[model samples]
Target: MSKVTEVVAELVSPIVTDAGLELVDIEYVKEGRDWFLRVYIDKENGIDIEECGLISEKLSEKLDEIDPIPHNYFLEVSSPGAERPLKKDKDFERAIGKNVFIKTYEPIEGEKGFEGTLIEFNGEMIKVEVKIKTRKKIIEIPFEKVANARLAVTF
Candidate 1:
């Protein structure tokens, strides 16, 4: 996480939790000549536009009061969508029996990316049932090796 994102995440976490939402992630990036600060928020069922607007309003007020960012940037509060990122231990635990896409820092079983049903997550490792050709195989991935992971919508 970048310094700006870390600061913004700390700033918005309380607001998000108070609103009965989870703070999914924060992104502070430069797109062309503009800077964007995107706050991803969600709940069990999902998040609505009204919820996003409420978070955006509350966070905007807080940001204005603190002036955390030196320059202008867009503050967008929205949902993590269908492909929600699995960042925490609880996230991985909850992902069991669900389809997910995982990318590892180094290749495991000669593959860096795996997409399949998450069979298990024991904090130390993840077991995914993937299909290779006509055979189903269970791939064991180290939790520490995961670079990125998200819910995958399988067709």
Candidate 2:
């Protein structure tokens, strides 16, 4: 995470949690001449447009007061949607038995990416059943080595 994102997360986490929402992720990126600060949020019962608007209003006020980002940026707060990234230990736990796509920081079994059913999550590691050709193989991945993970939609 960038310094600005870390700071923004720290400032926004409390506000989100107090409003019964979970902080999914934060990103500060440059696109053309504009800078964007995107905040992803979620809740157990999901979120509505009004909830997102409320968060955006409150968080925007806080960010403006802090002025942490040196560059001017547009702030966006919203739900992560159907294919939300699995970022926390609890996320992985909840994802067990569900299809997922995962990318590793380094190659494991000569592969850096895997998409399969998440069979298990034992806090420190996850086991995924991946298919190679017609055969299926189970691979163990450490939580720390996961660069990214998210729900996969299979049709």
Best by TM-score: 1
> Cα lDDT of all candidates, in order?
0.93, 0.92
lDDT of 1 by residue, 58-144 (tens): 999989998989999999889998899999998889899999999999999899999999999988999999989999999999999
Off by over 4 Å in 2: none
Q: TM-scores across all candidates?
A: 0.96, 0.92
Candidate 2 lDDT score relative to the true structure: 0.92
Please give the range of 10 consecutive residues that has the lowest summed lDDT in model 2.
69-78
- Write candidate 2's Cα lDDT for 1-155 as tens digits: 89999999989999899999999989899999999999999998899989889889888888889999887788988898888899888999888899999999999999999999999998898999999999999999998999999999998
Q: Any residue pairs clashing in model 1, and if so which?
A: none
- Per-residue lDDT, model 2, residue 63, is 84
Give the per-residue Cα lDDT of candidate 1 at 120: 97
Mark the 10 consecutive residues where model 1 has the least summed lDDT: 1-10
